[model samples]
Target: MSCIGNCIDHACIKSFHSMIKRELVYLEKFKTREQAIRRIFEYIEVWYNRERIHSSKGIMSEYENL
Candidate 1:
């Protein structure tokens, strides 16, 4: 097996965190852990993957980019 593969995964995660912070975390005021979890789930499943237009993919959502 090869030792090196997709070292950018860490970077990808960091970038995702940065984006989530900018787009949702910093904008919303959640009162509880439950609310935060629910909102984060919706942001990922509904907005980020399905609705948000990824610049690299040009008009296509992250799901489409996959």
Candidate 2:
């Protein structure tokens, strides 16, 4: 939904944005644009991808249905 209207719709990005808004954006008050950008970048690159326990990992990495 955030991307162009003609482009493909991705549910994952929407979910991510919602999470970021709830967890990071709502909690912090940035004094400058640069700080906000840096924090968001770090939040995703450092914390979310590396430390977060993703529910999709098993589905994506090892899919075995019995």
- Candidate of highest TM-score: 1
RMSD of each: 5.5, 7.3
My TM-score estimates for the predictions, one after another, are 0.64, 0.63
Candidate 2: Cα lDDT at 37: 100
lDDT string for model 2 (9-66, tens) is 8677888899999999999999999999999999998988774354456443343343
Per-residue error (Å), model 1, residue 7: 6.9
Off by over 4 Å in 1: 1-7, 51-66
Model 2: residues with Cα > 4 Å off, grouped in runs: 1-8, 51-66
Scored by CA lDDT, what does every candidate get?
A: 0.84, 0.81
Residue 35 lDDT in candidate 1: 100
Tens-place lDDT per residue, model 1, 23-62, is: 9999999999999999999999988777444555577655
